[model samples]
Target: MRACFSLDTKTEAIPLVPLTPDTLASWLEAHPPRVRAWVEANGFKGKPNSLCTLPDEHGRIQGVLVGLDTEAPVWSVAGAARKLCPGTYRLDTDQDVAWLTQACIGWGLGAYRFDRYKSAEKPAPVLQLPEAVDADEVLQVVDATALVRDLVNTPAQDMMPEHLAEAARMLADAHGAVFSTVEGEALLSENFPCIHAVGRASSHAPRKVELNWGEDHHPRITLVGKGVCFDSGGLDIKPSNGMRQMKKDMGGAAHVLGLAKMIMAARLPVRLRVLIGAVENAISGDAFRPGDVLTSRKGLSIEIENTDAEGRLVLCDLLTEACEGEHKPDLLVDYATLTGAARVAVGTEIAATFTEDAPLYGELEEAATRLGDPVWRLPLHKPYRSSLESSVADIANCSSAPYGGAISAALFLQEFVDPQVPWVHFDVMAFNNRGRPGRPKGGEAMGLRAMFEVIRARFGG
Candidate 1:
């Protein structure tokens, strides 16, 4: 909800020069001897995200040099924003509107810091809005991204189910959208049995929060988020290290809320429905245990093979509800920090995306490539569904197989989704283990921009 950029019409803003390995030598050769000498002395070889400051005859800052990979991510300029001295800077190179937009976004993102709890914090270096960039669009992406980061960065103590619902309520209020919730025992009356079951043990009551906006005649877009506020792994329980960052277990909910904010802020033509099953998988006398049979809103009984696989249970009932009613959504997208197997398969930075729609997947791939958000496609292998087969229940919440955990998880959710509808599942690592140029070491929004692009293209603003 805070501004990410400051527009400056002044011509005296400091220049930021982006240089690739090939271009660095030539650019340095063109500069003054002292400037070139200082850069070489500092070991500035134009490596991606590397920076060097040029000084004038009076040792005053003249300009900044940012090293870039020829195929560097759009956020390459982020390092300069983060490391540079506080000053108003502008991109000095020639680039298209898209490139400028991405650069601005990178700068804005790098400027982010979660100082909500800190007593004192330094301000980020300022970036002047580029001339050709669409200010509104850039700000929308940055604000939504910041929202995701802020929500995910907050510890579970302050980010419980009630807090998550309050955040959704604020978003709905801001957009003049319809907001509703089925909390606690009401979840049972509403037939959200899986949601109720998974969340019943937590002192903070679990609920399904929904926000609806846009015209009724417009294309419908439904976004489902697995909002497991904290996962102590239920009665089965998680080890100490495993439970440490469980606060981010609700990354999926943060993602959808962030995406919803973007769509509504952009005033896209599509009617949007955002549903979050806010819950905490806490250990207690009432916590649902392994082997417990839970019936979903769709009447499918799920045998809980592992209480840690609680995200899918929260999502199943929400997805079932989304597919119902007069008009089905033209597109349904769900985000979850569902499986560590996905992180093992593609590492932490890349989101493991699963969708049956080839054409939609193609569009998403292109958008990811162009936008510099990375998402790797994994099969929703139907054969893996056998891994989830249970003799007593309609399905098992987890696979018996050790491998293909991500696939099995996708397949499990696929049961609740209608094949005719376009559905995408993003099993993302919402936390960055290490800091990168624009992405910090805390909560990161994976695949958000790429998914936003797909939605934007499908139903134009």
Candidate 2:
């Protein structure tokens, strides 16, 4: 099933019903005796994500009942979508609009498949838009998420700096936006020295892309993403297993591109600018070595403590250019698969956010909870800022301290951000290690929905 919907695209689909522990009794009462008997015989008692297929007198599927865990409806919906037989279906539900919307989105998400390299993918269950659900809204989120998954799941060979730039350009063109990129030696001439330094080792030179959309009069929103296409850890090389998933290091770029797609599709009343620094952190004779000092576009000198921590190197220049450059934003947000420390703190499933703006963080957190997309806000912890201090440069790319690595990393990036600009940073484990009902074990769009929710609420189209 494609993850897209429109009001005109109606379906003569089968029924997929949802039941919760609290409402199962009433639901059973309204159904026919045969249906109730079938449900009872199968021990369908509305347990979380449990299912039963009700048959008619002729022994054909009359309807399918799925149990719901109200607190996390996405899981329940995903369970149904994944387990159901391949057929066209529509929600036969009486839940409120909020619950139904979640169901539609979950159904779409569950049906997702990243079979780009395969000759053919398995047929998936198809879903019709549930009543009272906004098809456009659901499509916006699902399409954006699919883009993230596709980009991040691809290997580094096909998704290098230029390839990432092409993806951005396509997205920009599709949305009627202006797209531009500064690549290779131009990165150095453009004063994006730190970006140049990290990506210069590889044949595919580092590049930065900028996309602008919406009218000038609207609220200005700037998004910066760290696009390290592949990280070989430079001279501070990672162990074997550690180097395996480095292809997903550019997940932050995938995230921002997906987020930007949502913004433009929703036509939110905001002037949006997306800045992504795409580079490959490969090791060679010319790799940027540890202890080297590099100057960012903001002109702040940074000491490279460890080349493995290269996400921030690319981002510092982008963040500086986003915050202080022309077309400055009213609100600035950045995404990077920056630290293992964040994954340690929140686990791989839930993404972590760092922002000095407490209220902004609170708003995004609340929206995330409501949408079943888990997110957390870690501290910009000023006390830990001292750990990044350097004797030779203004700051170090990483800290020597063993603990609080996530906080210190955030502190490092904060050096380039304009404090006055409302800034938020996301540190995500963009790849999912475990396969859940809807969320497969590949690239995931962490916190993308929650951030979109806040932006939409603040600046409606």
Candidate 3:
């Protein structure tokens, strides 16, 4: 992935121009008037997502003009970037590069195509590096995002429970973090009963990936991700349409791991603990029934209201285990593609995040705002707690209420965390329904950067 930043203002050496339909006539009418001749010769229409090369009298390449429909749409400059000729260019006028800076970062991201299974005949187009952009930092962020997208985009056949654990192991090895995993029957012995029950039905088996780093004396930050590798919705089967993209259910793990990579790369000063409960909600004779009562790591029994709601089940145990661990962290955060209710509430682009800590929430919001990777905070209303009450078990995995489904899901996870601990839960819709700049219409890394920025600011880099 490669990128270049541009300014529209005129300069002696740098020659780049913004191509908009409204500006086309004025740009042609003014300065060096031959600019009009080039438009006439090429029949350049200046349509959105269009591109044209500018040349001198001898037909030597001078600069380039790109048509952007919406300036700074979360992932800007992503549409026509891949189609441009490979070279360095500058903008013809002055516009804020803050959005362009982030947009160009996304072009590097959209350029990513998973060619692991098969190779591409032509390599992705790489833009000449720009002076204003930190090429290395842009590549690092874009590459990390691609890493998460690639991990989630891979099919379950290649990305199973063991494979997810292997991904963690590789990350741990790269960063030199202490890595450990509780697998198969060991999950029961380790008191991860929900994880055991959900995974026991699969031949691939269920496991938890644990990676820890930083000094014990530093502030502790724990991340718990729900890694339901392939969700068939278990006995509570999903329709064909609903299950089509189930491979991305483990997107939470990808996000946490991606964020962890950024933290480790930047060498932030805080103890980081990552927990992933990797499982497959496959159908078999041994699958847990909807009416079954399962004990969790926290000793609370929960009744299954919907097997489709397994993300919360896996997270409940891991959250308790994380909070109860030695040297409890001041902050604990979990990310998951837990509910469709979230997508309904906030849509796909903005992930729904909630936190008990005001300062933490404010910092996260500011970080997202600064980085242009925004996440909207949803409240964890206490009145909704009654919706999760269970007659058979201590609680139910899902709520009976039709309203506030996203809120109820957050409340369910909140039950596992210690009351005094400041925590955040992100209910993210990790896939993009429509293609846009920087973000292609496929598996994407939503809240990874914003969360990383917040942690970096709250602690240190």
State each model's C-alpha RMSD to the native: 1.3, 1.8, 3.7
- Per-model TM-score, in order, reads 0.97, 0.96, 0.89
lDDT score of residue 257 within candidate 1: 94
Candidate 2 lDDT by residue in tens digits, 14-80: 6777787778889889878877787889999898778888877787777888888778766667867
Superior by TM-score: candidate 1 or candidate 3: 1
- Which numbered prediction scores highest in lDDT against the true structure? 1
lDDT by residue (1-461, candidate 1, tens digit) is: 23446777475777888888898888978878877789989998888888888877788778888887456456779877679887677788887777888888888888888889988656556777876788888889889998999999999999999999999999999989999999999999989999999999999999999999999999999999989999999887889999999999999999999999999999999999999999999878888988999989999989999999999999999999989977999999999999999999999999999998999999999999987899999987777789999999999999867899999999999999887789999999999999988888999999999999999998994
lDDT of 1 at 118: 89
lDDT (10s digit) by residue, model 3, range 1-461: 33233332233342446567887777778757577777778877666666667787788777766665454433435654556654444444455655555656766775667668886545444444455656556666877898789888899999999999999999989988999999999999888899999988999989989999888888899999989999999999999999999999999998888888888877788899999999999999999999899988898889999888899999999999888856788788899999898998888899899897888889888777766676999999999989999998999999867899999999999999998788989999888888765677778888788888788778984
| Candidate 3 RMSD computed on C-alpha atoms after optimal superposition onto the true structure | 3.7
| lDDT of the candidates, in the order given | 0.90, 0.87, 0.81
Q: Which stretches of candidate 3 lie over 4 Å from their true place?
A: 1-30, 37-50, 58-61, 67-74, 86-103
Is 2 or 3 the stronger prediction by TM-score? 2
Q: Is candidate 1 or candidate 3 better by lDDT?
A: 1
- Residue 277 lDDT in candidate 2: 94
Q: What does the lDDT read for residue 155 in candidate 1? A: 95
lDDT of 2 at 416: 86
